[model samples]
Target: MLHRKNTKLINKLSTALFLAAITLSAPSHSKPVKNTSSPKKVVPAADLSAEDKLFVELREAAKVNDVAKTRTLGSKLESHDLSDYVLYYQIKPQIYDKGAQARVDSSADAAVEAFLKVNAGSAIADRLRNDWLLVLGKRKDWANFDREYVQFVLNDDTQVKCYAIQSRQAKGEDSKQLGHELKNILLDAQYFGEACPEAAQGIYRAGGLSKQEVAAMGRIALENNYEGLAKKFGVDDPIADTVKKARTDPAQAFREFEKKEWRTGRENTAAAWGVIGQFLAKKLDRNAIKAYRLQHEAGHHQLLSPESQEWKVRTALREGDWRLVKESIEGMSPAIRKRDPAWTYWYGRAQKELGDEALAKETFQALIEQFNFYGQLAREDLGMKIHVPKRVIPDESLVKQMSENKGFARAVRFYDMGLRFEGNREWNWELRTLSDKQLIAAAEHAKRIGLYDRAVNTADRTKAEHDFGLRYPTPFKESLSPIANSIGLDSNWAYGLIRQESRFIMAAKSSVGASGLMQVMPSTAKYVAKKIGMTNFKVSELDDMKTNLTLGSNYLNMVLQDLDGSFALASAAYNAGPSRPKLWREKLPRTVEGAIFAETIPFNETRGYVKNVLANASYYTALSSSKSPSLKQKLGMVSPKASVLSELP
Candidate 1:
């Protein structure tokens, strides 16, 4: 059934991709109906004449979606600026504009004016509001409307524009007015996050609000391990019983999850099981949790009814009692017998340990003959070095005895199982539903193990889905190969960098003023232009893939050179400016992998940025639409977030 589902998904994905390709490449449906495709008819913003501007205003009026005004506005605007693609998209749907969408929720005139006033107010239109949507689109009034929606705005006759109006009694900070407004705002944002920003802001300022009112905030703080804040706010006082109960009893914590109390469900489970696992793992031997993990790992209970045998085995295993191993291993389903040889082997060991010699003998014989893994262990027990058994044992119970023998066959079986069935045999993290990067990696790993069928399946899945393999019209080979060849860079490495920087979404922009494919800030681009002797350049040009790649790669080459050619060093330089790597190098641990990077990489953005880029590079190489770069070599450094710099430059 599992294989069948996966196969069906594969076909569906193929069909979906085919449909998407056809739709995206097709021509417009209404070229003749009104033919709005010509470059001249759709004049750019800068090219509109006075009459055109009136036409533009009428079109804009039409776009505002005021149905009553659409006919009037559309006729007036003959050559209006329609180049503001984003605004056009937003307004088109609402436009009663005399004509556009089939249905509109409100009057276009009212909605448009509301949108314009909120988005394009003087405060928003001027340099005051740095938000791009308002500055360019005259949408400053939109933010005001948001404020109005939250009831945060002062009524025209209310005379409380700046002061807190909730508490009408007093006006000063000492007055309850400030406290009330502040608390409400703070509560809104703190409890509801994005859902209640105005209230969040109120809560932020209401420093005097009681802990009871701040329960949500306090809970968030406590969950994040903010004990100090919890204490200061007295959040524990109101729900002291719940908090104390959570700390005292973990099974109780799981009850929340069981009851579908999702807010605390995951938190409670993690905290509960974390404690349980810690208690057993630290207090017991390796064999203790073997029975437990085996259930989560190997028990063949399909995840559909997850609480079945898998849950049962897990519960039994966490006990840390080797005595229960017998019951636990035997209790697993028969299907598990196919997947979990460890269960068979361990059962035999248990029988032997219990002094069941006759049963152990039968089990060991099979372990030696049928299961090649317990070869030496089985051989040692039986005291023979003869021909191999093609397929000896039929029953899983005998396989356990073979493992107890601890021969070559046992070792080989253990080795093979470690890679596949070692963990909870459920294959939860097994290569299913993997990302493009992950699937490719899984494919390579499967290939290394000679699992050609699995590897090809994984590779084929990635091949169809990964944009690295299928993007067209831009002749990837022509545009990207040189970048790869020049710096001994892999095509995928380049692709990863490009993907992260631009998503192949050429119009992307960063808050820090970075532009286009590589997210190069205009100033930085200008600096590069000057350094590289390139003239007449603009940040807008970064939208061009060829231009962006050239500049971004050149800058990368420079950073690499600065770092004496170490990829790790170069990557760090790219993220944290060129100088931070040296400072971090010294502050970090002297081990081959400097783990102090978590502390030394001061900027969270850059630290994560470096990790993401490196991870992306590794993924890109695996995609290998043409020839992939040597990834194992490049990724030789382990636990990337651990801050390891390999010997390679």
Candidate 2:
């Protein structure tokens, strides 16, 4: 089902790309017909304009894999910006052909060289070069790989980095240097794919990796539910095996885990039990707290991994046990405890909840040193203002200079032709070379061009000279505020969520079919529209500013009331659905601090959504009121729903 959905999305994007190309080829004043192809007055291929004819024939040739025709048509593409891309397409398939390796390598090298010669400093060229490098790495062509590797601007690919390490080792480099590089990439659990695993194996063979390093890698895999990865690294044991089983069926896994005679190792056994506890926390199993207590009672509390301690925190929070929450947090490794702001904030909240006022205030004061989501909440707790940084106005001269840049011009053209994704790539590629000041200038240009979402994102890339205005622009003020007001919703909160949901991209549609600034799903929109007495509502209306705002606000308000006016819970419900949050709340043994409840949310997406929305709302509120807003008040205690309501939205 997932594969089918992904394929459908790919087909949709492909169709959109084709339509965009046709649109771009046409005159500016021409009306786009419903049927893009075979339009009412189609021009003959010979009669088509030069650029249009080249593009059309080149696409047709590539579609049929007519390499000869592609090269012929591509040669006539003229000295234009797209010529290199056309040539790349002409050569791309040959690189992947099941021909002789030397021939394939030669073709790929030529393609990279030619493309870079013409389209130097372009994102498309970089992408093509990366693809070529992958082929070179696969074929073990170190000479070509070494030559191209240094020129790879992004250098962000883990696989490419792995190959580079492999290349160095092939050149008789010491294993110590190779091991140093491998260790850095190994810790990034996000990319434990073939390249890194192979690199790890190579490092292990050379005595570069220790037993603890291998186990740590395996632990990361188990924690992230990737058991096969642990197996691939040859770090498997009963504990790791039990962790995998727990992910699928916690009760069955636990029953089997405990049946073995105790004596393997205390730490290993506790680690296995901890994985089960984490699973139980995710499933909200009734026995989660009991299981955690049993593990602790067996004197293995010192061996509990960060994941195990995290679940212990969740299990305690479910019952609003402040003492246990503090204990669980304290039990975690100091490194883990110090790094996670969520845990830091919760520890303070737990102290406050348990009547340790001075300690709570001290914790929050220390935690507020970093300006982040939790810092905002800490400020709210301390009654301090949430300061929106002064807007940094870009200089007109710099903005003008960026406006006339060739890359910027091409990006704007792509956007004009409705190729948003392509336009974004072009825009970001240019941004890579810009300083913070230049990025701000480009953001101002994006705003002037009415690409508000692009403007927001462009400004967001800046690390210094914080510009809150560009980051949190209220594009549809008149429409959004009134709708929010009518529904008795917080205008700041409404806009905050909209900003995150769609980045204020009014016509944006999510991959899942949710549309407009609020990203309301079709069914949800329809239901809300009807409930609000919108008799003539259509799914199409969901993309309109007034309609989407009204419907989305109403739905938000409905969930807010349904969940007892707890904004954090309501925000989670808004993202995940009303039913899941409702069920998740019911899993709680008692009322828990709202921030703790939010951090413990099972769905990563919803947990992030809630936190970001609240944080955004805090900033937006500060911007609007010229005073601090209380994120603490927004995230009030979240008790379980009074009773389960069978009827749901």
Candidate 3:
């Protein structure tokens, strides 16, 4: 389904009006000023061709599942340029009902096959095939599923992957290899909608998985808050009851589990303790280490899922228990330890803390080349600083060629209609086979078209050629710099926050109602406006670039002051709220490195947000100034604060 956010239209219209009002209100001098700039020409909605309007309306009808309206609109667009999209929308409601295993009749199958055959090799064909594959898998139609699954390009759906495994099992394929594949896919329990849990049950019945392995899967599911999935693994009442208790009072759960003996076996017992540890760890409860210790003493640490193991390490980091951190990371599967740079960096830090200087140096040396948040930290750990890489300018001819690409044109049209999901899929689908130089050109094209998010994402895909300008484009520096500087905030830091907040999308509105370039929430915007003594500041004005930057910069400065000038804490406050970082800070036992505080933030979104914002700021600094400060320098120390002044919401 297309996710349409009407906030974009409201923002765009308000921005235009705000600019027009400013132009009209400006004082005129006696001397006539010559205007050399050509006015931007905007095509009115009425100017759109009849076919274009019908196609857009068809998309809107499909978005709300208006089957009758969609059919009516689809009929009008039968001869349109994008009739394939209309066809997809017409048949989509029949097969893709949310949460229902759609029963496909012979006619439905014939229609889908005809669509796929007609639109062969197109992105929408692959998309339709993907959707149809899920229904076939659910219906246990193995022959058709196998045929369509192979043709399904962008096989990125976890449920579809699980169903494919089940289809293999039904065909008497090797159970051992299929079981292994199923286990890897089942690791992501959060997206396991019916198909994965069923596949796991089938594997267990076939003796391809042990009881302990199934119990471990249940524990991982419970850890991800998918209690329904856990029950599907046959988790008993005792273990489920303990998990319920652990959600609110993990320490009590840990204590009770340590004393009571369950008949459900050691494996279930270990699972309970692992989950309790995860909950306790998120709350920064010291007993989290004790719960993990109980699991470790039972020799069931190996049974803990990778996510559970990572939480154990995070809890240890918060408590300053370096030995536990090192032990937990070493106990992780070699694949996981090598895959996540965060764990690798933490492992190196643990090694250094445990006095293994040579091993620590080796770990940091290898990690420094990764060029991410942790990579920057690893560089500083190795006594080096970030240096701006030589910028690779894209060929102008290649950039011009990108303008002629059909996929990009479709993506731009979807973007203009506020269908971001379809827009992003269309945009990224064409990027699969491009060379690094071509990728650079594509990113430059996205930038020129004001698709800043796509520009950043595309530029970030480059393996060798680097262009920091395209990756971190500063679109409104003239206005942003003065606003940030006037309030004594670093403009680079503001730019970094803006880049992470919205990717410079002018009409960006988050699900929680944050608006415009900086994604300022209405309440926060109003509060900042009132505090700054601005009159008649409407919530609608938050969409204007100047207003958003001003309010966001002021709120950021306020948080920075409240948090005692720590960028790490302020960034967290910006993503989450001021109260959360305050509570997080108040829980700190003593002064610690800012990186440690950021790594251990309970909310996953805010933790990554803080790291990315600070890392982005460091890169922006390197790009803008001669004296580049290290990421560590920007992350300054975070300490326990007794009181903070601001009452920011």
Candidate 4:
């Protein structure tokens, strides 16, 4: 996930931090082991030995495709403790080139094979195998790909899976099985990179899949705005053009569509309508309801993807059309309606509105114990409050065991060097086989090391035991609470936003320049500082704990006041600017429950952000007060905006 462009910034920060800090001694160990009793001392990269520094440099160099530098640094660290990773960095560029044709150096194959043989069963080796498989896959080297893929421990990459399917087809494998596998991979349209589309086309050409099936996949891709993918499936020439027109001017596109007869058949026609309806629904336009209605009337609702089907329901939710909501949800794939709690809850609400109380109650009961935003709302619908599971503490010996884990130590080293992608991969690889107790202990270790993000994520993975303290940590409560209180903002809400924004990482910086705990944009920070009368404020201070908390809290309070104190609206505004939420509220046909509004948020990120912030706030409140929290009270109602906002940055 870490891109080449960001490597420079990461390197600068890592280098400065390394030079400024000291390393602490680690426990003696032969091989990287699992779990610890006490917190292992963190070693700053600056204090690491020459070999360790070279390893970090090698990682940095490899990230930016500096092959020469990477090879030099890697050679120096060949005898280091984590030499495998160094070797991986050295060979990775030779096999994998992003956005370029796969060109494997002649020596890379043998070198990678040797490395994989030596570090077999290790995470680093598996990673190298994965990279090597990609190259082999691109070259249509089925012999190498088939061999390496069988040993690939984590078959999680979409592109890799697509390549495997291609390999299977090349070897005259069962068409039915390959088609089924290709369908599953193609359905993940958001990540539909080059490989999957190519495979789909190949499978279709080879009579493994039908034209209509491939077209449907293309439609799904178009629903996700993947025109390139749609083109690859041979569905873009006419349908993609209509979808593009619909995006720019839905009403006009609808008129044009109605006036024309398609040679592409009912499926493509329905797909176009579904896409138009999806775009219009995001704008809160009633025409979206009409578009979907036409699609349904044509008996082609089945053609719409799960996402488009959900948008049809969202459009109805904004219109308070319960009948349409029920109908749209019914048209969705059973897998979607049954799997997504949002749809189930909304379906229940629709049933209740249609006087089907028994069905509604059953649906609400099913979600009462889910412990999410929808689950909380479902519980409230059943006349109950949010319940926090009792905390389970891990033993000190377990914590000590986690601290001694070499994988975690490597993860910590990567984190110290600002390489979160590698750090997260290392941390998660170690967590694969951990028990509930071990998970809690790992989370505790992460918490002690100021890896709050890792701590929260690790605690969240526990299946049986729970720990609210680790899950909803209030790291800077002493400083954050006073600022929130002084600014008339709920401290719990601030904590939730901070937790979601930066996970308590003091030096966290977003892609768009939002910095520090609250992830405040530089522009927004400047505006807040000017408004709060903080003279001579510098943007550099946005990374300062006090400055970030103060400014972010003030901005949040401003949005809350401007938006009629609706937490859902204010939370959405905080994530997606103050103006967009106002536009969303103004376009609403009628007042709706806060949960409905949050669900219908146009921006996917903001929609999830609002729900998470509110949910996290509820948990924080419950943890702090030792009482059941009222999530409904926190969500309140979201009505049409009064339109009084004059200036908000």
lDDT of 4: 0.78
Residue 334 lDDT in model 3? 64
Q: Residue 27 error for model 2, in Å? A: 40
Best-performing candidate as measured by TM-score? 3
Q: Can you give the lDDT of residue 284 in candidate 3?
A: 75
Q: Candidate 2 at residue 323, lDDT?
A: 85
lDDT tens per residue, model 3, 313-341: 88888778899889888887665676779
How many clashes would you count in candidate 3? 0
| Ordering by lDDT | 3, 4, 2, 1
Instruction: Please identify model 1 stretches exceeding 4 Å from their true place.
Output: 1-468, 471-476, 487-491, 535-545, 592-604, 625-649
lDDT of 4 by residue, 2-62 (tens): 2223333433333233223312221222332321211232333666667666676676566
- Using all chains and alpha carbons, the TM-scores for the candidates as numbered come to 0.34, 0.79, 0.89, 0.87
Cα RMSD for candidate 2?
A: 9.5
Selected candidate, larger lDDT, 1 vs 2: 2
Off by over 4 Å in 3: 1-57, 60-66, 98-100, 104-106, 234-238, 261-265, 643-645
What residue pairs are clashing in model 2?
A: none
lDDT per residue for candidate 1 within 1-649, as digits (tens), equals 2322333333333323322322122122232222121111322255545654444444444333343343344333322222122232233433212232122232233333433343342211111122221211122234343344333221321112212233222223443444444333332111222212222234345554443444544443343344555554433443333444444443453344335434433333333333222223322223324323433333322211111233233333333233455665565444554453445554565577677867766776766543122332344445554232121112233324322322213223322322222111122224334565555554444344434333444444543233222221122458667875786654555555555565544555665667666677666677776676788887678778777777777777777766655566666776556666655544332323221232124454665555455545643444443443332244233122233343222
RMSD of 1: 23.3
Candidate 4 deviant stretches above 4 angstroms: 1-57, 64-66, 76-81, 98-101, 104-107, 170-174, 205-208, 223-225, 234-238, 261-264, 335-339
Instruction: lDDT winner between 1 and 3, please give it.
Output: 3
In candidate 2, what are the lDDT values of residues 148-223, reduced to their tens digit? Answer: 8988988877778888888887887888778766765654455555556666667777887765555655676667
